[model samples]
Target: MHASREPASRSVVSDVVADCLADIDRIAREYLLEVQKIDDYAGSAVVAQDLEETAVASMELLLRLVGNLPIPDRLAGVSEALGHRRAQQGLPLESLLRAVRMDFRILWTAMLEKVPAEFLPDFTQDAVRVWEAVEFHTIRVHAGYLNELATMAQEKETQRAFLLSRLINSEGKDPQLLGQAARALGVKPESSFIVAVAAGHAQKAFRAGVLRAGVGQFLHERDGALILILEDVPARARREPEGTRAWLAALDCFVAPPARSLAAVPPMLRIALESLPVVTPDRPGQRTVRDAWGYVAATRLGEYGTVLADTVLGPLATISAHERDRLIDTVQAYLRSGSVSETAAELYCHRNTVLNRLARFEQLTSFDPANPQDAATVIAALHVHFLRR
Candidate 1:
């Protein structure tokens, strides 16, 4: 902003202000004392020098602008550097802006103290012009502050992604590396965690939703899948279960059962990825790898498992689909309960009905789901068959 269109009087006022530069150190000191009342900027020794420098820089810049003298590039450079440094420290931008806006009032006070009584009229004419200059300097300060914040945000995300990679790809043998990653991510090493995997196409939406859920801690997309790590669910999320539930249900992904420590996470991550193929459509909220463990193991067993399925379950294909489903469900329930009566109760049928189905299953497959010795093989066959279906 021009000091004045009326050059002579403006130059006289400008010259008067220029003569006041010798008192600048005192003025800057006063400015420091004044802002400290609102905020104890000196509390951070790292920024203590910055407080003094900011005060001095503002005064010098204003003095030059009033004199119509060339403002040094360093003045603007100092402003930008202040923004970058404060943001790098993760300090709020509000304090800097509040301090910056004080420059106008302080500049007026300095001029009032130094300018001779005769020059009062001339200096007074510049009230609007000086305010305009303060507004302009403030504009530069805001620009610098916002640019630095954006840069800091990007740097933090890059660091976060690097830490997540170390956690996911690191071998389980390195508990120390996991600890380091936990520290970097602000998560405790002992915290329970679950790993999840979804289609890569859902990556963008998943990222947006995870922020609201506030559960998932680490996220990244690899190959054709999006990997997400979940930690504590906030109380707010627990109260509004449906929001979080629906959010999770929409994620057609495999979520591994919760592991009690960071050391156990690598296995869970592998399990989540391994179970993805068996993930049925929208398994709804909080689905885990427990139910799909058999299928996941079967997938790894390759041809050996296919043969097991053919030998044990191939007979069932001869029967109607309805009968095959009923028998299979009964056998699974009987194996789970280990009691015919309990299985019948669970299936909401008579105890004799549970016995008949178990007998029928063993008759066809030559393995009894109720016999502990044969149950493992029976389950593996059923898993492989289910996988094939």
Candidate 2:
């Protein structure tokens, strides 16, 4: 009889409980569907955690609706859940705000079936304020994350640049790295090579340009020296006139402090390196470009030949090496043996001494003193000594 009397209250309780059950099912399904979409967007297996968290959130709301907690407590729980989800995503405030707004729209549509129409406005307004707080904190986290990433990128670039500079300046000097650097810099590495060494301490820049222009090859500079590797020329450049022109152009345009001297490898390289004018006393002046090359060629030959000659002649002679050299001049004057007196007069030498040196030369060479062939051989030897030294 007592249970029958409270039927209206009992029916109202049953209806409310059923509505809450249905609301829980709807929220769970919606949360699952939304989480799947987010997971697809994130493209990471980590998104599964966020999906589980969302499922937990829907369960919490369901418990709240069923009176497992007081209204205020339930609202706090929902706020905490939303904050956790936003933090997990590392989303900015604006993005979280947008997401929260969407959540409210969905919840409002679902609650319309159970919650009083008059209560909807107040509920949405309260939930939005809580979501705004969550958004603000999450945005700060997102901004910090972005700043860290930017700093990392800047540091990486700086490290890369330093390594590249060190590689360029290294002394071991890898050929591949040099070729790659030349390619990157738009310079040709393969070309006829030449070296123009500038003198004086202050004219380094002038030296650089001269060396670069003269070589027409990739230029690599070091302290007081520039090493040029010509990529264009083959292992041999015997007698190329065009190659010579290019070498000259380089010397003419770039060298400063005026290169006192230039040298190249391979004896035949002069076929190219020689075309360039030497640094004259007037530098590009001196109407007669008299082959200064003879001097260079002679000097190089003398380096080796002098050793051989010194071994044979000893240090002593009728006079000093210089005087002996002067006496040798008589050979040119005696082209046809005009007369010993004439040669002596030309050389300012004594007649008997000239005859004695001729006798000594014939003895050493095992040739007859008076023979024409012996005279010619003596002249040829003298000529080589003169030209090489």
Sequence-dependent TM-score of model 2? 0.27
Q: After superposition, how far is residue 320 of candidate 2 from its true place, in Å?
A: 6.2
Lowest lDDT 10-residue stretch of candidate 2: 254-263
What is the per-residue lDDT of model 1 for residues 1-389, given as tens digits with 9 covering 90 to 100?
A: 56236767766666667865767888899888877875536454446577787778878877776666787778857666766766666556787778778888888887777667887776687777668777777777778889988887688777777776777787656877887777766677766665677644455666776767875556665556777766544223433212124576666666777666676677888777777765554443345666678877888888999999899888998899999999999998887779988999999999999889989988998898867779999888878887777
Best by lDDT: 1
Single out the weakest 10-residue window by summed lDDT for candidate 1. 235-244
Task: Output the lDDT of residue 41, model 1.
Answer: 60
